[model samples]
Target: MNFEYMKNFMDSLTEWIIPGNSVVIYKDGKKVFEYSSGYSDLEKKIKKTGEEQLYIYSCSKVATVTAALQLYEQGKFLLSDPLYEYLPEFKKMYVKDGDRIKAAENPITIRDLFTMTAGLSYATNTPAFEKARKLTDGKMDTRTVIKCLAEEPLLFEPGARWNYSLCHDVLAVLAEVVSGMRFSEYMKKNIFEPLDMNNSYYHTPNDVIISPQYIYEIQDTKNIVELQQKEHTTGVVKRAYGNELVFGENYDSGGAGIITTVDDYAKFAAALANSGTGLNNNRILSSATVKLMKTNQLNEAQRKTMNWRRLRGYGYGLGVRTLIDKAESGSNSSIGEIGWGGAAGATIIADTEEKVALFYAHHMLNPQEEYYQPRLRNVLYSCL
Candidate 1:
């Protein structure tokens, strides 16, 4: 497969919007291509190598679901089991009606968490979150915070629609409860240790050298020229930590809390791409379960809620986007291309059918996924 076109496309991204970026591609459990472009620190003129550790933000969801699915493989829980069976705090859930909150007509099920149909909300400023903070003295422990989250009402009835919320975070705490380990611990023993992903973690390692991330301050989207200017795009990312989503040292943010290098995450991606088998020939999941993970879990009405620009012609699968329509997505890739992205320009694409996987990332907060994600998929497939 020729990667010249992929290189050119990545180069253009550096020239225009992306400050710096890197990508890793694996075919049949082998690293076939890896490249980097642009500057990690634009003001310092530091070239961005593909090895820089990055905060993968929401890409953590992919790992969260994988970790939880490990427990599923052990017959720990069923998809249709009521969520309250594991987390007693959710025994009674409330839903936000038009003008007032009311008791939820349906109970949330384990499947709802996997499919983003649990009606949970991503809003962190809710009274429940604040209560969690005060109760834990800002430690925001996964179980504590999630239990407090149950105090808030859901956005809709469970299984009614898809909403990108704290569903994965809820799922993470469930994994912790089932395994009798902290969310981070469970991930380490099951997902990271088995896959040999030593660099991936819930907390940023003190020794790993990471580039100072940046944010593209959009002066005004109406004025497109400003978006291309250096002053508008390059600034030290103001966050105090590697990931703002990680509320405290004890908090394992299942939604937006993974710090790892491109290759580190690519190992996980490649495992899924190769039908849950890693490069070392260790199987993390059965091929049958991997197929279920990528299968579209959204129905027609539920799909209507997954109307993000980048997710056109796709259906929400088990914590990932499963491609169902190539024409609608304008993609050349196969129909079941499954993966997810992060807030700061991390994209995961795994095609189990083709035994290929890709992890592409730029350490910028506002990486334009709408423009780059679909095109990157199309371009990579073109090269193949």
Candidate 2:
């Protein structure tokens, strides 16, 4: 792999692209390139390094999905099984009909959760989601939050549309209920330990120093503001940073809460790229399962209904985004590339067609600048 273009990319981060950032690329189950730039903690003068950990946001969904698939391999539950079978609270769900609410025509299934067609949403404007925010209030655990979500009225009929929602968190709850283990415990045993992702955690450990999160405001475009204390957001019941956030008595957000280093996440990505085998020689998932996870589960109509900005060339997979038409999507990635990103600027992409895994981690909050992932992918693929 070429280093010249990557060097220039890292230099741009130092030039105030988005505070500090790190990138790791693995090809053929081996590290081909790695780079880190700026400070992990600007106020503390801590330089970013391979060891630094950042919140992975929605990327955690991929890991959660992996755990569910492992359970699937064991015949724990079928994707077609009604979600109400696992969690009774989801039974008899309602949908908003004009200004009133009515019973849903059909029950939501586990596959609906995986494909994000459950009609559940995270939109704060909706009364249901607003209630969800108040119900969680950083106090309820994952299962409790899921129960609260089930009580809310869905935006549409199950499988009628696609919306990025708290479906994964519900899936995490299902994993817990079926496995009879805490969500984190199941993941630690089935995924993390097997793959040797030592630095990855559902909650930050006490000994681990979390890289400070930064918020880039429009007024201070060049200046990245560091958050001193952990900030809580709506529908999420944990802090945004630090040990209290991770180890705190709160929800295990299968959708958003994970802390990991670029190197560690690259290992997870490499495992996906290598067809379910990790660098440590452990098979965390079966090849058939990995193939299923990376396959596009959405139809063309469902793809047209997705609202995410970065999903132009992609379709919903079990948990990650699978590239379906690179030309139509205008993405430089391979057609089978699978990955997801965090609310912060972090992203990971595993391309089995090219035998490449790429990860980029940063702590900037709600980055208002132009999207960086496509540019980064184009540059990296060009180097290859």
Candidate 3:
């Protein structure tokens, strides 16, 4: 339980690499290590502290999946349920053939959304994705988003390939429709309140004013320079396609829209490490459901064709990615460790076998920035 090495590492990291807002590592549902560096608002000289919060972009997907898992345990919905069953707007969906989007051979199901195999996509750099962005009104609500995507063809048939898309946002809306509750309310009642994750929320409340932060843009000469800062008065900003859009009060996105603190998210990661039960003795979900959520759900061929060069055996299950191979991800721990990161530099990985969890939260949007996944895995396991 010695964090001297970790503390030293954090100090060096702040001076060298991305100046982090906060970092914490929980072992067996307990916080043995913690650190906060830099400032939440560089202009106002506001410092980041243990109590301060940050938006954890895609990291919120884990909460969305957790909500879906609770519903699954209660027999509210199955993974195999067709998207059209809950949101009928997806019934007439199709993919672009040549000039026009053609009808798909089969309809997209809830499982496809969970696995990220649904033909829908958010990145519009490619042809199909560009078409998808144009057709969907650039929003992530269930009916409108899916209906807009329905007009455009999927990048590929369902369950055929892996494409990181807006499937999770669609899942969030579907979870609410199936559970008969608002998305944010569902998570608040089931996860946030139960786990005592008080500082986390999907919609930014009026009382809490989110501050602006700077991100470094690397130049061709490898020089890291500071970029612009975005000020927020009320709600969090989520970028899709090329537009920066704000979510409505009722809008809930399953894919990426969660703001939380290091302490609060540590509780979440630790609870999942403890099998759906928090350290405060609250059972947010059943142990069986948590186990099911962490298992590998991707087929052999689909796992191999993913664009993520470092990820080989990783499978998208519920909201987290399961480890299918120890070598590809370079983890020495158990094969069952499942987790993912946000667009901004927020990450959490929970190992069920070792009963350990690690959390890193910052406002940086570098998806490729390397840190505590494979590197921390070796260090954490070596100590054990």
TM-scores for every predicted model = 0.96, 0.88, 0.84
Any idea what lDDT model 2 has?
A: 0.79
Better of 2 and 3 by lDDT: 2
Positional deviation of residue 147's Cα in model 2 after best superposition, in angstroms: 1.4
lDDT of 1: 0.87
lDDT (C-alpha) at residue 228 in model 3 = 16
- Residue by residue across 202-269, what tens digits does model 3's lDDT show? 76777765545345444333222321121221122222221132233344667767777888898899
**RMSD (Å) of each candidate, 1 decimal:** 1.8, 5.5, 5.5
Candidate topping TM-score: 1
Please give the distance, in angstroms, between residue 62's alpha carbon in candidate 3 and its true position after superposition.
0.6
Best by lDDT: 1
Give the per-residue lDDT of model 2 (tens digit) for 221-301.
Answer: 333242212131211121354422231357788888778889988999999999889998899888899889999998878
Steric clash count of candidate 1 = 0
